[model samples]
Target chain A: MTQQNPQYKKVVEYIMSEIENGSLKEGSRLPSEKELCEMFSLSRQTIRHATGELEKNRVITRVKGSGTYVGDQSRPRRKPRYRSVAVMLTYVNSYIFPPVLQGISNTLNNKGYSVSVSFTNNDIEREKRTLEQILSSDKVDALIAEPSKSALPNPNMNYYRMLEKRGIPVLFINSSYPKLDMPCIRLDDEGIGYEAVKYLISQGHRDIAAVFHCEDLQGIRRYAGFDRALRENGIVLDPEKVIWLDTAGVSDLDPLMDYITKRISTATAVFAYNDEVACQLIRGFNRKGIRVPDDISVIGVDDAEAARTAEPPLTTFPHPKAELGIMAAQKIIEQIENPLMKRDHLFLPEIIVRDSVKNLNKEEK
Target chain B: MTQQNPQYKKVVEYIMSEIENGSLKEGSRLPSEKELCEMFSLSRQTIRHATGELEKNRVITRVKGSGTYVGDQSRPRRKPRYRSVAVMLTYVNSYIFPPVLQGISNTLNNKGYSVSVSFTNNDIEREKRTLEQILSSDKVDALIAEPSKSALPNPNMNYYRMLEKRGIPVLFINSSYPKLDMPCIRLDDEGIGYEAVKYLISQGHRDIAAVFHCEDLQGIRRYAGFDRALRENGIVLDPEKVIWLDTAGVSDLDPLMDYITKRISTATAVFAYNDEVACQLIRGFNRKGIRVPDDISVIGVDDAEAARTAEPPLTTFPHPKAELGIMAAQKIIEQIENPLMKRDHLFLPEIIVRDSVKNLNKEEK
Candidate 1:
């Protein structure tokens, strides 16, 4: 490359210089073979070789039935070259994840970086595959990923390390593996859980039933909050009253329906994992002639659209969906540009009170 | 013009041949400068020159802490090159669109292409900006877009043509513009509408009401079905009973509640545009002391998660959300590989009978 082929290199540089100087723009038609031969004072074969080298280098393309034209390879002068980063999440295209994605995309797009998103469906294997694919990808300058089954040890740590080796920074969103000292934008799920149960206890409801998903770090942390609140309140955490759901998605709600119908007298209130479960619990209770608050008070977390719009307006804690996305994107962009800049962000959940939770001191269930 | 420099050209060709012959692979660590110099029996300066030229050509990258390695551009023999495409929707992180996004991602990923997602939020200005960004992007080889404000004439047709001019294929999903003539995978929304009304009529409900959105092609097309069925049943469509909503997101439902309360005596059955609206109508009816099927029968489209979980599960036509996505991806990939290939796909909506719709002939309001 130091001692270049003089003639073809001259032709390539001439066209490239023209492109660089704004005489040739993207999709602009290049000079025909005869015209190039006249301009460079070279044979048609020489022009053909020059254009062939250009095509090989992806500097131009020969469209079928159309003339040769400039390709997008040559950087546009007026536009900042838009670099792209990716975000890999557990449940994309779900009820809860979209707003977060919206925030991330808005932030990244505004900063001139296109965002690529991948969903792992909360499967460890898919997560491993996705991380590997992303690690090997040259187009991605950085990444924001939510580790799958975060409470358990992951097999994909090597991929993350590989990104580190390649000097491509990765920021975690929501949960992260305990061993990986990664930057993350996370919700204080444990604190939210503690607040939820503490609020119920403060309302004079001593017996609380908790429905939690135990597989991920978020669920485990939230349960820890539940345990802490119950301990501080001088109440025994009932093993029989706890419902553990599968981590991937909605588990069989039949177990919960049965518990709601048969074991209602055991607990005066219920703390659901999120608004979706709370809504389902309400529907289940209504089937057995048990009304919310009037029969069993219920509260949940993640004040999603369903929480606000659902009948009785579920009382829960709001996760910073958009804020999380924005934070994660900003961190990744900051890291991509500076490479040395790194930061961790945490968003604490705020209690959203609605009609679901009843004041036990004022009324009897 | 056709002549090549003997020394650097030989080294470049040697390494390329080694790569092509499976001696070097992607992400494989190349020999160090000292070893390469000794192996080639060349001076350190010559080896440095060759390696620098390789780095300039992106044949290899030199990590600071780590040794030099072959980059993705040199081509791995075992792995196929991963291509990237984009999916642009109005609201990507919404209820209805997530499943479609999922479908697109799953389909494209399976075919070895990475997917980048963008949202325009149904704003024309954002759509124009996003399209311009995508058009100028070299990474996105194809696009699947749901045009914003599709009912009105678009100002972004020239942008779509720009994608065409750059040889990027486009496939529309769910709804499309009338004049675009681009390949699209659409739902038979009008057919679903006709079926919903016909089913209600078959159940001896003639006083049927319809609520639709007028902003996009789907809304208008579905309304056509509603009109056709009402006319076929010999019932005049009531202008007052027909409710139209904005397409961007959920509009305020206060007007709809007013219509439901005031016009309850006029119509016994109402068909909604989708499950979200249908769920809201059911809630409205409940607030007014009206019961499902017993007082009013409601039908909707898109049997989303809300439809299944609503107090009385909503009866509606199922939107082929994932299918449309997969079809669009497949079509885009097909056209990308073979630009001349052009075809349209239509997914017919099927009725999913749930508890929301009542048989009016057997039961009286």
Candidate 2:
């Protein structure tokens, strides 16, 4: 009756009540194992056992890698969900994205779900068009997406509402702009950026410059982290040292190149919002006859492929891209099972020290 | 009536006859626009209009982005397919791969097919497990995979057969070995290597060294190109100048370091199998106090992400990553619709001259 109940038993009781009360209706999906793990404060193994028992008792039906679902025999006969989901993304051929998508596909596929992939390329119009096309088909039972132009308000909230109106479960990844009263799973972009700056400051970097994208949620949030870190450290930010980027032109770091050259003597360290920019910054530095960790230190978020192979390797923050995708998939599946649930997830970034940062503290001593 | 019909009308007749005659049958997909394009020798727009009319008449129902299919109006109505596909790769987060996958997803997605992504990590066991898991689900209607251990015979060919047995279409990307009677989309690995060596020769580099991955198909093929080029130029391959790489430890260029340190003085140029190896080779040369194109000219194949950002911005061959992926997706979709097609695609690599390969002829002049 209280918290004294063993978690697994409580789980069984809670699901039963949901079904009996019609909160969890027949022939609908159940919350993902991950969600149940958190809800019951139990490990996945325990949740699995509880779900397994339910399946055996014919109280629920279990699909591998997919979540448990309410059984027709448990209540009244009803049609099972269409084994289909829509996954919308932006910038498919670049860093962080492919892995995230892979995570989504693997998780969905295991559970016998078919995955439809759509790319908006971060264009709002394209996002709207793609969403409309997918939603109108009504083939997909649920949808998972990365909202385009995530830092700005979305113009396609109506399509999202249509998804809701049609009883399709919806979930977001990366940035969930125009919240649409829906749940999202994203990285702690601001936190990672803040930590990166803090780490640089800890290594005795005072005059640090940064390259960031200005148009997206990740860029804006990371810059906010950078700003917050400097403010807390009593270091005033210099507008001259900030390089604002358009996410679409990420490969063209010419602006970053100019900034690195002009500020070579003054800025002791450079921070990039993502690993690709960091690698570019290093290349730009090399072009100007500046050396990484010697003439200046470099730090970047997202310990992506570019960071690993960049010259001197890069000191970076781990973005946990695949995990975010998995979480997003699970959230959408859970929503499909229960339309009333509202939960958001944010994964934190971790630091990985490579050869990019210069230890000014040791030299000062 | 035999063959004088307008191609679009012919296409319509072809499809309906197949359905009515029980050849194409029920529950099977119709050909893609591209396939229909080839078959009818008509433009895509014409084919689109023909399919559009069919969709409107409800003789065939079109799932957006997925192919059109015949429907049985006399029987109880049922929804169309899952519109799902499985895309398996060796890696997801690295150079050239992300873009390739993006192309596949984008192409398939436009046709309304869902994608299930799987990673093999190039381990045969992992490949088998991933394939089995995908096959067991039977959720995917078609599959596009990059064969792992592509230079060696696949142990998981049986799983591919199972996919065919289940009426699911299969296609390969990058390389196809064990010739599972399925088609593949790949790059001309040998041609690129041959061209790289020839370009280096044109620069008057008589003393050349090469780094290769001897295990994979690309590796062996590229090495063959290297050897053929040397022999054609009346230069015998010195074993000391050949640094064979283990594809698994590609990032750890320690073996390459040893090669550069010991061979840099005698070797005037180095050819790397891919851009990753080229970038690493440059770094190794730098560690040995040798500058790229100053002490040794460098050329590489598969001008990947590493080549673009490397210190010298490597002179390499362009491996059409995205096109290959796109081709594989289209091929699989075609297979699903036809089931009698057996066409393999191999894309040619082109030269991209950057700063890494030094022109010794200029110096001589």
Candidate 1, superposed: residue stretches over 4 Å from native: A1-365, B1-82, B248-250, B263-265
The DockQ-derived docking category for candidate 2 is incorrect
User: What would the per-residue lDDT of candidate 2 be over residues B6-72, giving only the tens digit for each residue?
Assistant: 5576677677668656888666788888999998789999898888766654567777676677763
Q: For model 1, what is the C-alpha lDDT against the true structure?
A: 0.74
- Interface Cα RMSD, each model: 25.8, 28.0
User: Candidate 2 on A1-365: residue-level lDDT in tens?
Assistant: 01134457667768877876799887799999889999888999999878877776566877667666787344432222788898888873278888899889999888888898888777666787888898768798888888875643344788888888888878888778644667778878888878988999999999998876644667767876787788789787664466554443355565336533564358899888788888888888887788898998999877889899988899998878888778777767666765544567788867999999999999978
For model 2 the local lDDT of residue A294 reads: 95
How far in Å is the alpha carbon of A52 misplaced in model 1? 54
What lDDT tens digits, residue by residue, belong to model 1 across residues B92-189? 22677988999999999998899998898776667877888886666788889988757543557888888878778888887887756577788888
Per-prediction TM-score of chain B?
0.74, 0.76
Where in model 2 is the C-alpha error above 4 Å?
A1-80, A263-265, B1-365
